[model samples]
Target: MWCWLYFYIFLVISQILYFSSLFFLFKVMDVFIEFQILCFNSVNVEMAVFLDWVSLMFSSFVFLISSMIILYSKSYMVKDKNLDRFVYIMVLFVLSMMVVIMSSNLVFVLLGWDGLGLVSYILVIYYQNIKSYNAGMLTALSNRVGDSALLVGIALMMGLGGWGYSSYMGDFFLDMNLIMFSVLIVLASFTKSAQIPFSSWLPAAMAAPTPVSALVHSSTLVTAGVYLLFRFSNLLSRESFMVFMYLSLFTMFMAGLAANFEFDLKKVIALSTLSQLGMMMVIFFLGSEDLAFFHLLMHALFKALLFMCAGVIIHSVGGCQDIRYMGGLVQAFPISSACFGVSSLALCGLPFLSGFYSKDLVVEVFSMSGMGLFIYLMFFFSVGLTVSYSMRLLIYVFIGQFNVLSLINLNEKDSSLMLKSMMFLLVLVIFKGSILGWMSFSTPYFIVLPFSMKLMTLLMILFGSLFGLDVLFSGVGQSSSMFGFIHFSLFVSGMWNLPVLSTSSLNSFTLNLGKLYLKNMEFGWAEFYGSKGGFNLISMILYEGLSVIRNHLKIYLLLMWGFLVFIVLLAIV
Candidate 1:
């Protein structure tokens, strides 16, 4: 009955050993081992395994988080009849991520990439509800754009003679094919990571189970793009980096702003995930791949725990996801509330937490760089927005008045498995960053800044917390200005009309085109020129032939006799 849990436990033990060994190996030497399964004349068509410290570390984290989630789901989804199927799909999801992590060849990368996409769609619609169906569609279509870009990348890679992108790193060929490939790769990353226009689906995909959300948003689906970009960092053009830096920064700001305006508990976290992903991408484009990866690993640990905490809260509230209906959960479910607070604070990059290590390093590194004022201001501003939303989430969920019925049971101890999984990650969320930072970077980055510059991040967090408090208290009882406030809230909370743009605006035109196609092609043209038209034309011709034959038979005999007499007379003459 608990076979799945046993498998996950085995995976966790194996990954911990792998991570520790790989960490040491990475310190002593650079390890890049490639195994080829198939080879042709000059072109390699075989599935290959690429293992190094980076891939191994990421893979270990993936298994670690996955095992925790599966263990968590044992209690979270215990009542569901299809528990085995759920476990199976979760296994496939983890396996697909592993394939992507281990493969250097684009062919196998695409295989795993597509697997992630396909399996994600399946998971998104697992609830079999209308919302899940719509979310799945949005998720699928948004990712298809990335899939197309990768397919184009594969085509361009053929001109470069092989699918192994690892070999092409640092050897940037300034040719059209290479340039195009790099652009396509960035495009692919943008979609997979839910950048800008693709941002809507990440929030919508919250229709999935919270365990799936934790897995997808943290280490698997959304992070897949960041991982891909991390691998292809060297292949990217400076121009592409410059262009996408602004885009990724804008995406970060946008998601943070939206999260502050959002009332739905799960979506606020989803938007926060989007914001962090954008932060990772922007830093990567700004010439700090190591820091970005560091942030990514740190993020996965806490964000997954964050979602799990939210799941426990949601379950206790009897599936009500509206934070407006929730308040003072700290008193009811103290363990989950404490875990949620820790995770949210980590999200805000509070001092000494896991998120702070990478986030602080990112800030120091950016300040040290010679970027322009727009980049500098926007980066910190977005960081403030991050704190703002986390404050807003915490206030709405933990400090506000509890609006639910008193009869509801909000006990945390009942779900001991869930609590255990969360506590395991809870420990990491507190200390993983320092451990990871020490291990990943051989030497420390010595940042020298003015006193004012060093205090900027803390200042932003303080300002953001105040801003969140103001927003929460502002709209309480102002009926006169409520209309304008509602409109403003709608616009911001709707992600600046991105969901409409992605779904309705784009869909309206396509849906109309489909209607036109149905009317003209399937109905009008086919009816007039196809089987119906042919049948009618044949029937008319046959009727005319039969009528002509019947009428001509009588007249022809008379005419023939008269013609015969005239011919005989002429011959005689």
Candidate 2:
């Protein structure tokens, strides 16, 4: 009971801090813009000293999303036995995310980064189930690897005499290792963002509660990578740029493919998050920092909205998350279905929606960079896949005939207040780009819209919609037995095709080399002599020797005493 009380108190304090910090951030932005106006003519004033446009924009999104998630959690988590614990960790997670965005110093940023990771792990395992616990452990372990890279990057920055944000901004031009550190930082970002090999953990994290999934997986937490990259854009090197470009493109394509195959509603969103992160990375890599930031903001809004909607659907359906088990939910749950459809449209990059502006901006920037062929093709394909899977989600859960109505006692009521918080997010997803024009970091780059790019987006959406339509008309079928065989083959091949060389072989070679060296030297027997058992034998021999020495010492002391007594007698005489 005391623990519960303290947990509630902690939650209250955290919420207060988070909102207070957000208020301060807005104030800071106002002051910063004013300062820029007043000091534009002054040679002493530096733009970096104030909250830059990019930071201000991203911070606003962070604040908004964090606040919405907090509000939503209240109702979503009601009646949960671990309500206090959940509230406590959720608040801390939001607090850390806010700090990560607002902090000017790298050390403070890292503090927030690590704190967020820790809190997320706790939340992932809040259910204390074996599956959730394993998911949490895996996430924590992957994050640790990322954190180590970040720490090394920080160390490199410090070694170059960069102790604070001011120093980094002032000496950025002079620091040669800044490029190396920037590369390391991007590696950390990729891991945290859950790209490629590290991404497997994210889908597994669906084992977490929906609110945790909604906030952490879809919005604020995954955005941390893009945030870090944006934060350190000035120091990004050419090599790092290429690396990010390739990796982002690859991750985007692979995640899209994975999403196409996913059956679980949450896993689909999880993979979509990975794909979206990849798109954001590509934007950042192309030096379109403003566009990237806009994408990040748009992504947070729509993705979180979608996740919350999924949560509501899952809850209404008696915890049946398999899309196949759901149908006609649109008729049953109009409000949730509407919200989900809107968010999905945005996610699919539909025209005039939140995703279109941001995602199009990324594509526009890619084309302008003259490396358009591969990047555009990969992203184009992924966009189609996005539409396909999103439609699958919509039709599977919201369209088709009502099959699970009896199971869930289907109602037509709107989602709870917890789920309603997503409505605000939906509004933002629709209007954020217009509210904040493509954010400029150094210089505002004019976004050129191409007919080809617009056409490609439309075509992808059309194809995806058609595919979804086909599925809806044809009705759900038992996915071919061929799929199981394919999975088995992939698993077997992946297991057999060891990506890394055998450690046993390497160890055996080293042992053979050691044996050869020992044969070359007559005193190679010294190794055996220095073995544990040999050491024990030597110690026993030393013990015997020490006993003899101790006896001799005792006799010498007695003789010395006798000599001293004789000398005393002579002196007395």
Candidate 3:
């Protein structure tokens, strides 16, 4: 009882602090406008760092979303035994995210960047189960690889006469080395954003608790990589720009494809999040940084709401997460079903929702970049895939027949008011973009026509939905064989064709060359030291060679000893 009381008290305090900080952040923004402060003077003599429009916008989002997650978590995590530990780690996570957004120096930025990753890892493994622990470890390891690349990129910038964050911005475009640094930075961003190969860990990360999923995966942490890319957009090279665009497009397509096959609820969301981040990456690479930033904000709102809704469903159903196992839930849990539907439409980028505005803005940016027909067509295909998977999730979870009624056992209670605080997030997902409009940032692309591209896109979505439903419900596309022989042959050929050097071959060549010269030198040290068989074999050769030399040197040693004795005798005399 005391534990519960303490938990509630801490939650109340956290909520107050969160809301107050958001209020303070807004006040700071208002003051900045009133004072007409364009830039700040450098505080450090060694490194010049400036506060700017981009940093300010990111900082505002980080603070606001972090606060909202905290409030949402308080209710979401109400009954967990480790509520105190959860809150503590969560607060640190928010603090680190804020620091990442606000820090001007690369060192400080990295400090926050790494700190957030660490806290998130701890939170993910908070359940202390084997699966969750492994997932957390994988997440940390991948992020560390990204962090190392980022650090190297920063070091390269510093070596090129770039002092810190300030030198990477305006007027610094003349530096040639910025191109190399930007390439490395993009590599780092790809890993952190979970593009292609690095993306496998994200769906695995669904082993974590739902709040961690809602907070880290959905809203803030995943966006950090894309934010970094946009932050240093001016320094990006043409090669790196193409690399970013192509990789992001490929990842988006692949994630959508994978999500269509996924049955796990959180994994579906994880893949969908990956796809959305890829879109943002493409937008940023195409010189639509502001639009990407805006989209990122909108993505956070709906994604978090969706994840939270998933959390509620999982909790109510006693931890059944497979979508195929869920159905007829619309009649059983009206509120959750409604929230899920709204969030699904938002994820599908339906008009008037937050996602629709941001997603359309991204498409418009891509269309204007003169990238040609191929790129645009690829993006259009990705959009169709996105709709397919998202609708698959909606239909399977809420609208279909309840296939696993025994698993859920309807007597289980609905979530409490604390859990339901997530409804506010749903509300925001529905109206935030329309209510605020695009003026505060830039006006969103408003494309108008009769049989317009937007209408065509909607038609594609409808087609995708029908196709996905047919595949899921009617078994239209089901296959018993996981891979055909031709596909397996191609996969093997692809792996064999990868350009990595064969380490075993190189090692064998070197060993054979050494053995020719040292054949007679092998003997004895293995026996003397009682070493492992392999080590003993090598040691014996070294010992035999040294022993032979020592034996030969004994004659010289005797001569020197005799001369020393004569010299000592003469001195004594």
Model 1 has a clash total of 0
* Poorly placed runs, candidate 2 (over 4 Å): 1-50, 170-172, 412-414, 438-454, 467-573
Local distance difference test, candidate 1: 0.86
lDDT string for model 2 (1-573, tens) is 433344345445545544553555445443332122123222222222235445545555555565566666666666687776676777678778867776656666778889978987887888888989878887787777778887887676655444355445656767777677777788778778987556666776788889888878655678888888887777667665886688788888777666665668898898889888888888788787767877887788888888888888777777878877788887777878888999998888877887887787776667677775766777777777788778877877888666674555466353566555777777777886555443233365576667876576678778767654554444334344223333433332222222122223435788888888877543456555556558889899999989878799787889999999999999999
lDDT for each residue of candidate 3 in 5-55, tens digit (9 for 90 to 100): 444554454455445434544454322211222233532223223445555
lDDT of 1 by residue, 15-44 (tens): 774666466556664545566666676776
Q: Choose the strongest candidate by lDDT.
A: 1
* TM-score for each model: 0.89, 0.74, 0.75
Best-first order by lDDT: 1, 2, 3
CA displacement after TM-score superposition, residue 561 of candidate 2 (Å):
34
Q: Which candidate number would show the highest TM-score if scored against the true structure?
A: 1
lDDT preference between candidates 1 and 2, better one? 1
Q: After superposition, how far is residue 245 of candidate 2 from its true place, in Å?
A: 0.7
Question: Which regions in candidate 3 have their CA more than 4 angstroms from the true location?
Answer: 1-57, 160-163, 168-172, 407-414, 442-454, 476-573
- Report the CA-based lDDT of candidate 2 relative to the real structure: 0.70
Cα lDDT listed for each candidate: 0.86, 0.70, 0.69
